[model samples]
Target: MPPRMSDAVTGPAWASPAGKPPLSSRMMRATWRGLPAKRYEVGWEPGLVVPAGDGSPLITDHYFPRAEGDFPTLLVRSPYGRGLPWSPQYGLLFAEQGFHVVLQSCRGTGGSGGVFDLWRNEAADGRATVAWLRRQPWFTGTLGTVGPSYLGYVQWALALDPPPELKAMVVQVGLHDPYALFHAEGALRLENVLAVGLGMTYQHQGMAPFLRATLRLQRRLREATTARPLRGAYAAALGGELPWLDDVMTHPDAEDPYWRGASTAKAAERLRVPTALITGWHDALADQTFEQYERLCRADCDTALLVGPWTHTSALQQGWPEVFAESLAWLRAHLHADTSGLRPTKVRVHTGGEDAWRDLPDWPPALTGTSWYPAPDGHLTRQASTDSAPLASFRYDPADPTPSLGGPLLSRTAGPRDNGTLEARDDVLTFTGPPLTEAVDVLGPVSARLTVSTDTGYADVFTRLCDVDEQGRSVNVCDGLGRIRATGHASSQVTVAMSATAHRFAAGHRIRWQISGGAHPRYARHPGTGDPRVDAITFTPVHITLHTDSTLILPSGPPLT
Candidate 1:
């Protein structure tokens, strides 16, 4: 079934007298523990029509507190329709909090009239909505933008040519680079691509259709993911041809003309808006949020960041309380000149193993780089080996590719999960460190430099950082993938940049570094024949060798002497 908006929280609270605020509005405010609502009654104007740049009708909904007073206006543009989650989460909830909220559907979605063309139409359509906003007598002349996922993309689109009324932005589990979303390290991210197709094609159509589509995708996932010549493989699951998905899968190069202007990183570089970013440790776009935070800092834009222990969808569902509080505080600070609720620090992150929140002046506080080398005997040690003897080996078959478990996926299976079964696979290599006598804190970026050789010149290296407990349950922390194209029988040195994290390897726990050829579905399996994975017709098994000189680099809090 399609996940419902009310699944996050429940309330039996009654609405205000005269049924002014509505049951949904009262339930939401009571459900998510956040700032107190400023008003008990909310006025809603549904199905407001606004004109797009090309004269198409953009459907919108307006929400405002009924009490007398001008309030800051927030513009939310979404491709996922203006119902359910969007209506209750953004439209009604924020309205009760004293902000005039404008919730509009993107061109061609919801009731909007036009052809949806992905990122192409957002900017012009956003500006057109703002143009429509300026004409409203109750617009207040001050504006902010707030939303999660693709809704965040539209904010970046508008910031490319920001209107004068724009002041603040809250991007929750946001996306700015479409190319990176589809491909990672030159390989297609097959499952995520199909998930996106399912969302865009069926989600906005409403509950029943979305539930059917989700079930169809689940039933046909394996067939679609393993199909030969995969360009049109997702048609069965997605219900029809999605030309855009086919186009993105075929164009693997980010620099190609097909994706020339896809990234909105430039918007961050030039934006002077006070932006607040919210993401989960396992969010699929957590890396993108980090990149955005860094760029905003370098540009000297007033910014704040909040990282939690959740996933892409959970950042809005399970993590909604913290997410909403942080967003409301930032918006109130910038748009309403109210800073009482703001935190003292600019960055706040949740430490995983310790399960505590840490506030810092900046992300990735200065930390010492610790190197752990992999030994031939399946051990992880600080000491480097002088002789490269006892080379570790494995065989990866594309016909039976390595399965992806958890961590940073867009589905329900995302986030931290036990990796005991995954590590037992013959195709995977693991190096374990001795149980720690003292707690070790890891607070920043994680990377791996490996010396590897494969029988086939074309291959991919999937490296992951895991924490194994006393009972021997291995759970993933962060991981990354890199493709290697080398000459026959020659060793290749490659660096895999894993996702950054703020975690604690508790006392009595061991650290493990895992290496494999690929993580299927999360990333399309390499053909091992130097051919594009989408177009490759032949599958080959590869024998991979790992040398002792490889090391895992971590940003550690204290020296582990």
Candidate 2:
């Protein structure tokens, strides 16, 4: 049983001078664009201590509208510190809109006590926070959770054994599986791992330390990523040794006991709480959001999805106006019991190339599958090739691995990027279709089926879907990487799931299928020796051959006329 409301010892409230909005709050309101002026001034209470399940102290801050009414409460648990963007964006902004927001730091972060163990402590700490909330005089007995990225993961963690007060949830650019974030197919996602390591190590210390760490990573990323033995290679860039980082980097297999219970995807399988999901086309966890939505729909749970043209970080920065509005609307409908601001559609996606927002009854909306095959002279044709020869061949050298420009990443360099210079490289093979006579809208999952043989028998295939403009500049849309082990020099048929997209390929633009051995740094260069990436010391160069029978599969509306 939980303690009574009066049993908790809450610290003093920290109001702004004369109950006025701070400069940062004013700036956020101006820059957030579409949001109207807040209805009330926000009151803040900082440095409140809540007890975790194991009696450890978890530091927290409270934000509320300075009005005379009882409002629903919102819970946001983040590993990132309670400062700057989070304090202003979620704490003050949402509170001013008539909700009591409790912004808390997970154990071992933001002055909280105890060692942070990634996904292990979240569930228990969340339940303990709610137990504390139950004793707060202003808790209102109604609750909703809201946040982005790892913060979103905390929401799912709490949902695993949600309290009766938990009613609504908003997950923005979120990830459910740490293993998937680090390893794709069989290759390690080197860049994302390093970026995450930097954040986990320094972001909680302070702004100065985090900025310095970011610069350090920027300066030494190449050295760290290209190191001979991959294990412990990121220590210089990340500041120091992180045992968890070393553990995750070394364990490439998902089935290993090390990764057991890492994924929180099961929480959504039968969730009854109303959930609102927001993601970007280039978000690292966009596919996870889609999978969550699918599971919610299958369970007949109320859910809404919003996908933008922004990246994981941009979904909160450039795309915040839409993301915030969607979140607020959902919270109001569920927690406040106000449906006036709800949209009529179940899903809203911003279409690229067309630069317009489309509201649909569902995502992937009953689309047709269009198949494009590779042909001679670097062309992509609608008909299959009967030629009995290899379509193209390229040599991949681990020493000078293919550079990854863009697509999906956690860093600022994510999203669609021009592949002109990259396409000019000998290691990349591109087969382009003719100029589209009519517009082609790609609205769902994209895949590449290829038959390829490598001299080393162990290699990775990087496939990308690109939109080529009149100037011959190819911009990547969605892409995927697959690791394959061939048998006795026989060609292997590998299908790479390039994720999904909601984009328009305007008339006169061309569609291209780009293939390469690997996207270095984005994915660790395959050593070509079938050894674990972290322990492999030998780097071998391999010749790869692509057969003409390969095809690109896209989900679209109708075929080009």
Those runs of model 1 whose alpha carbons end farther than 4 Å from true positions after fitting are: 1-38, 387-390, 559-561
lDDT of 1 by residue, 1-561 (tens): 111223324211221222243455557656666445444356677788999988999998887766545688999998888777787788887876668899999998998999987788888899999999999877779999999988999999999989999999999999999998999878998878998999888888886889999999999998999999887989998999998888888999988898876788899997999999999999999999999999999999999999999999998887888998899889889988889989999999999998899999999878888999998679999998786543799999999999999989889888898998889899999999999998999988999988888888888999999999999999999999998878977889899999999999999999999999999989999888888999888998998899888889989864222
TM-score, structure 1 vs. true: 0.94
Q: After superposition, how far is residue 58 of candidate 2 from its true place, in Å?
A: 0.5
Q: Check candidate 1 and list the clashing pairs.
A: none
TM-scores, all models, native as reference: 0.94, 0.95
**CA lDDT, every model vs. true structure:** 0.87, 0.88
lDDT of 2 by residue, 486-511 (tens): 96467889999999998899999999
RMSD of each: 5.3, 4.3
For candidate 2, what is the lDDT? 0.88
Query: How many Å off is the CA of 3 in candidate 1?
Result: 36
